[model samples]
Target: MNLVTQLPVSGAAPKLLDFPAPTVSGLPTPALRGKPVPPAQRVYFYSPDEWEVFITEWASGLSYRQIKQLGGSGDRGVDVAAFKTDNGLEGAWDCFQAKHYNRSLNFSDAFPEMLKILHGVVAGFYCRPDRYVFVAPQGCGSTLDRLLSRPKELQKKFLEDLNKSSAATRHYPKQTLNSIREYAQSIDFSIFQSLQLSEMIETHRKTPYFAARFGTALPERTVVKETPVTPSPDEAVYVKKLLDVYNEQDPACCSDVDSLSVHTTYGKQFQRQRESFYSAEALRLYARDSVPDGTYELLQKDVYTGVIDTAEANHPSGLDRLRAVLTQSGQLDLSAHTLISVSTLEDRQGICHQLANADKLTWVDTNE
Candidate 1:
């Protein structure tokens, strides 16, 4: 058997939680982390608006009629639908029925509910890693254990149980035991990266990365824990440096960037349709936008609130102050029309800092 192709044994996955993650952990701390959406479950629990937000973020369609078609009801089940469309392997969405209550999660009642959500997710295409997910703040009793212990047969049984009850459950010809196994393989494990507890416990689970990291050193016949090697000092140093450079370049979040262009931010408008930066009326929204061939990605909020309020209120001191900031932080680049904002011409230190940060920016999102 090809060792690399074989299923990984337990002990090989990245165990960041078990490793006493360094205080200087390059990754963002948990405090900066946002709340996770619920795992799989049936029944709508989120407000109509919250669900709308989730759908809009992940899926493009979110009209009231579309919501009804997507089967969003806030009666008592999951709150948000991250991806509910039934398109293809990539589009096969993981529907979540958020069960957000003031009390702790009841996993015992929720695990079975996850099985139900999976069936509701049925379509011809199989999304890699798994098409279904359960979203709950806290789940029913032993829900995690039950989910962890679920056997192939049980998942099939769960599917049958769901198909029998849901009239809305579209008929999937391959709703058999084999299809469940195939679907199981397609299950996306990306969900674990979000759930703290799921990530913690996954330390003990078997996966490909675990194998690649530790290689084939198995336990003695008598039995004992497998010892995984930690990164050597040299390896750790290289990894740290590489990560530092990588972080500054990746634009998904904070990149030490130079130039970027996005829709402009027109100031608040009385006309319903005139508020967007993309609109022609919003061209005067900023002095920078008036420059030739200028594209604005970020609009300092103070620019709008301060400038507009000053001009409308007929305040000279305000205009002078606003004009001063522009001379310094013009958001200038050679490709960009020379516009100046806050810094003084002699502010060598400020210019250096801006230039250093700008070197990393690529108008095209490098992070993505």
Candidate 2:
């Protein structure tokens, strides 16, 4: 059965730990195992506030200029709003109404929220949103889903329900409710829709917040294959440092990149070092998109901590010190870091250059 069909519609929602352990089918070969719970199933356990926050995070990934969460009291029916311009609701915008409940959302649970928007528009709280979306963990009930699929029927149902005397919408002023009927009648109900739980989860997967929120593994990092033949402006500091290292070994060995490129031995070393630098650069770029901020910086800190003593100790030559520090960096136990899985050997070695680029490490003793 599908994951949603396995959920309970009443009582307390099931926790992640409550699910049965994966089963291994009996076989001589490796056994087949059950799949982990999908994000769609896990979302049912989030509190109402958390649901709105998730909607906010998801909305931020869309092409909106800004996303704001207005979920608490006096929010005027908007939970999370995505704006296309700085003018906010005055400009084109989309409203995501977060509905968290023990069961799927039905017409009764959604109509009041719908009225709030209509009322808000007529009351000058804000203009009608370009689109209105219902975000619920358990999705919509069969009746609500059917109405949403048919725009004209959904609009007709809203008008019919607006005329009925019900406590659900009683707080709306009589005059306001009467005025909203005309505005509601004109609303293109096609703009009112439900966000599918699976769609939200899939789209959220592309965002940096996904792995942290859903406890999912990050997407695999692509390898950086090419390093520039000529050094770029950003590589100036480290390249100069390498030149200093080569010159320290033998004063006339190399003066600059053009001179170093033809060196019989150090030329090969320079090429390898450049490749490693670019590999680490690739990791930095990948981490910026896949994980939270400072993750790559933390990795750099760990690498520096691993090699600082080796970098400080006396060496036979600057080349020896550079080699020893790089060796120590590769041996570091960085299993605690999030990027460790995708980090390559070149990336570890290249981070030493990144440190040098920041003037954190120096090969030759300047005091000498």
Top lDDT prediction, candidate number: 2
TM-score against native, each model:
0.30, 0.84
Clashes of 1: 50
Off by over 4 Å in 2: 1-35, 313-317, 365-368
What digit string (tens of lDDT, one per residue) describes model 1 on residues 1-368? Answer: 22222323222211111111112211111222354332222114555344333332322222211221133241112233333444322343333344455344553444454543333333222222232344333333354444434655435444455445343233333443234435444554233211222432234123211211122221212221222233234233322322333344443432211111121221111111111212211222332322211222222222333233322342233223323433333332322111223112222212222222333211122244
Off by over 4 Å in 1: 1-71, 74-92, 102-108, 111-131, 153-301, 304-368
- Which stretch of 10 consecutive residues in model 1 shows the poorest summed lDDT? 13-22
Model 2 TM = 0.84
lDDT of 2 by residue, 68-93 (tens): 76633777778777889998877799
Clashes of each: 50, 0
Report lDDT (CA) for all predictions. 0.30, 0.79
- Superposed Cα deviation of residue 97, candidate 2 (Å): 1.2
